[model samples]
Target: MDDEYAKLIRRMNPPRVVIDNDASADATVIQVDSVNKPGILLEVVQVLTDMNLTVRKAYISSDGGWFMDVFNVVDQNGNKIRDKEVIDYIQTRLENGANYAPSLQETVDALPTEEHTSIELTGTDRPGLLSEVCAVLAALQCNVVNAEIWTHNTRAAAVVYVTDDSTGYAITDPNRLSTIRELLCNVLKRNNDVRMPKTTVSSPGVTNRGRRLHQIMLADRDYERVERSGMGRVDDKSSRPHVSMVNIERDYTVITMRSKDRPKLLFDIVCTLTDMGYVVFHGMVSSGRTEAHQEFYIRHIDGRPIRSDAERDRLIQCLEAAIERRASEGLELELCTEDRVGLLSDITRVFRENSLCIRRAEISTIGGKAK
Candidate 1:
């Protein structure tokens, strides 16, 4: 009997989540048992938010690659979520996992054309410090526009230009700005090995420009997979930075880059090239099973190909750094394709299968096309 019971338990999925309602208490209790991994806390919290569920309290513990977490949650209506279907849906998603992929058209429709916000900081620096800052910004739905970081005398100062991705404008709201400031100040203080922040900061307003992208993929679409060819690849797979260049016999220069996809990735690369005096005549962007491939055909603004080896080397270094920064920042991705039934679910499943995590999403339809 013991052997049979052990076998049965072993055959079950590793992650087992249970949801229960406390009617008198006016809240739902969620218990999760799962394998431990980095960022699991963030993932669970994000799921609750996506469901419009508010967390009243949470207790988390992890040891020996296993974790047990319990969350006291309430629905948007400030009552327990007791619907069986809704509870089952949440359980399925948390147990299996789901992703929200925002289409490209959605980004164009939502982001501002010119206005953007800025964050400035000065403090002692250490390794992995920028990554931490970017992580916080990503969590807060802020996207970087321009970042300049410098260090001197063991003190680091950074000025980051950003835009609320949802609004594409400078964060002018006082409460939101205060929250960002407090969060960043706390991060910097911690990095400097200082005391914790004591003040309770205000919460900010978030305007919804479009639909939330975290709806779980169900039905046939969830089973579909994105073709590997749809995403491009580098011919020289062993390339360290996964970026290569070729001069087209004084006609044009071809720069091929392969990296994990992120929001505004193409924008960043093209912006860098344009700033460097190159004019793109044509380009192609595609997703691979695990990476994104981008090809840009261009020449100098003066219609001349990059001729000098030194200039070519400099360009290579710049592109490499840009790719590295995006990867570390953990940004979003844009998907554009002809719409069909279950399209969103299919696309999001592709990203999930490839190990891409979606932090935020927006979906919109324009001109009879879904973005």
Candidate 2:
């Protein structure tokens, strides 16, 4: 009854969305006003990220039963949004109350799926692991549909969408899935790994794939500092996000973060905090050419400020890991080739043979083409 009442209230007060190109000379300004609700902030951010726009700055305020956010966003090239169709699309999408959850799949670096099985894997990071994993899938007759992989702190995690090569549909045979999981787990395991490798198979959903990766790594505790630094080990402190927290009056924890700016950065930070059971009452975000600065006034879901140094340290570590998980470390590469069985396997094999390390990668299929 409470949930239905909230929905009714939201419907009664339609959101007011403004896409103003004149508000900021440097970037387009988007403002949304609506009845406050849980997860609405993330939904809005997800919409912009789905369109591939860079949110350079944002102001979030959801208090006193109302929600309002202002965003300064730019195109991929860091210019104001000038396309009329795009502007109209943004306004319509936000104002009409279309579901933003579906957009999350695209933001997570996967195209809308027709039918595919999501393969999740995590283990110690290694050079040839990807090649071995791909080879295992190809051997099992699973065709790569779309996927995203991230490696950090000497730990690797991947969400791969695969279909039956022969049927071009989700691999649903229980035996095949079990075999796929077993083989992939074997490929992920290392002799020196402290933790066991894991593999899970499921039909993909609207949940953001990138956030799913973050959750997987967090569960694997990738934030723990790797004492012995080597290849793919995130010992490079330079790339880690700088986080600071201070208790303010009225019992609020003010968390400030500064880091190199990237796409969907705000969303990543907010998503992590929320998942950690922290609620942001207010936030201010600003990003320059290369660096982003964010300040969030928050409290625990239990209505308390962060209590101890240990808790603070853990929070900082988790936030840093979330940021670094998606950091673009390797040379920017784009692969646009014909989609076929074993194509990904062959490509990964060449990279592994060349001793190339893949920090992060995304695979997609569109109109019979793969990228």
Candidate 3:
């Protein structure tokens, strides 16, 4: 019987949802593990919001195509939701499918007013950067009207236009404005700027810095040559990835990724390929002052160049998504205060009541203070 179930699970790959009662706490805990896809987190949160349940603490992590997320949730009045039927309903909804479209009634009833506001954010890029910003805005009930993002010199800058979803008004509340500024500053400043790490060059030819300079020169020369040959378009922005095939006595495709210099970028790209079941044969990685470029000669593990147009397009899409996710995954929030028994849980309960979800947290105490 166990073996049969195991085989069934392998074929289905279905999401697993578990709701566990926390006797020591006022919030019920829910855990979900599933094959990760875009918008999965959003769907879960939307369902909870629609049910009028408040999310107090959440931990979200995705490795390759698998994700695990845990949420602490409570009723709108900050009471534990212990009713068995309700619990079963919630679990069923989460496991049923991702096509559940939430109603707009909650947004309409949230805080209706009319205001338009603009905010500018600049910081080092990381995975999930846009998602984090958008999540913050969503938590605050701010609706994005328009936004633009650009990356250059290892920095990301965004200009956002938003309006209050409830009231359709600009964010004029001083307290809300202060909260927005503080939260965004935390997200932007907590991580180091995305730049190449220091390294030693034992190569007989040149030092690391000298090699980087040469790579930049080579990149510039190649750009000019491409323009002269009329094979590629020139743009005013920093470089993006260019993927193509090799036709001359080689059975591999080449992927050229050029972006603002970032740490562990190659690791992220490699992980994406591994997830897609591809194998790398030969590769070259180089860095410029504020940019990095990588070229990989690769083929499917079954030893075939990506041939189908659909598969090639998916490869490019997944690579871009992986890079973007890595660039934005540095979002975090920090707290510091005096410590006491049950203080941490008490704080989390408050966040839950206020409808603020904590995706992840690190806590420690020093000098009689909790941080």
Candidate 4:
């Protein structure tokens, strides 16, 4: 019974806990019932609290047939907590001579039904990996409803349930699902010993991007225009997109975009380059009513172009599509370049600070010295 209670606690990641123990002849009950000893129930409460759970109340009933213990735990802020509520119930059963703990599914079902999408991720743990995953999910507009993470003996596992407030886009479309999977795979591949299996589950009633055209159309118009300019010609055959690739022997690259395009759009564009096999060594974005531009100096990871002209062109098309989808109402995007000294130096500073190094450089200027 004592071992069962321990197992139950391990499964529930509660925010707070309060327990009442009913005195029984069982060793487990006796240990908990011995409240007079320090480091017993109080110790358990401390451990739970350290895990960010709060126990507000407890009750013990040793009467015949009514022999049970009850606890009232809430979130840190005193909200009613439910994740560990079942633990107290399980303790009651153990006190009544139940020898086995509940099944994993049964225990999971005992909790409240809040709206959330559960994702199971297993991989090698590294610094900043979790943050990167969360950032991608946040960028996709997924709200984290709950998260459970465990790492033991160098193995890491995470279970996250995400939900949106509108509840309209729960989970739909294979392309978006594939994109997420690909992103996770790429991130894991960067670390040794980290491998993720390809399996995803989407909750019903979620609308995927293919069905959310209206939301996509909210991007800035100027960004859409520049993005269109970046697309490849129809004749291109590469599976990726076509964009200018300059090997930076130096440390960075400077890209100029229209003032109407937001910094966020510029960042997305650079990330798109990465998705297309281009590794950004350094970059920066500046935007104003009169000027909006991003400068990136990057290098090919394998010391060669990752995408052919045709493939690069396709990526450019996708960038245009994404910009058009994210374009804000009434903003005009127009990009033009002016000459400046040490332009490369300034751009490299941004990249260096971000831990990117350039292996080549490409510079283009209009109405200014070409040198």
- For all predicted structures, in order, the TM-scores are 0.33, 0.94, 0.31, 0.29
The 10 consecutive residues of candidate 1 with the worst lDDT sum are 211-220
List of clashing residue pairs for candidate 1: 112-168, 231-287, 231-288, 263-332
Best by TM-score: 2
lDDT of 1 by residue, 1-371 (tens): 96676546544636789898862386798988876544444455455655667555555555345667777777767788878867877787677643432322232233322365646565444444555566677767775544344432233455455667678567778888888888887777754333232222222112111111001111112112223231232223253357788999878888888776544445445445655677665455555435677776778867788888988877786666444332332465665555443444455556565655443344443444555
Top model number, lDDT: 2
Of the two candidates 2 and 4, the one with more favorable TM-score, higher being better, is 2
Candidate 3, lDDT over the whole model: 0.54
TM-score winner between 1 and 3, please give it.
1
What lDDT score is found at residue 352 in candidate 1?
A: 60
Query: Candidate 1, overall lDDT?
Result: 0.54
- Model 1 / residue 318 / CA error / Å: 0.7
Provide the global lDDT of candidate 4 against the true structure.
0.38
TM-score for candidate 4, please give it.
0.29
Model 2 RMSD to the real structure?
A: 2.3
**CA-only RMSD, every prediction:** 24.3, 2.3, 19.4, 25.5
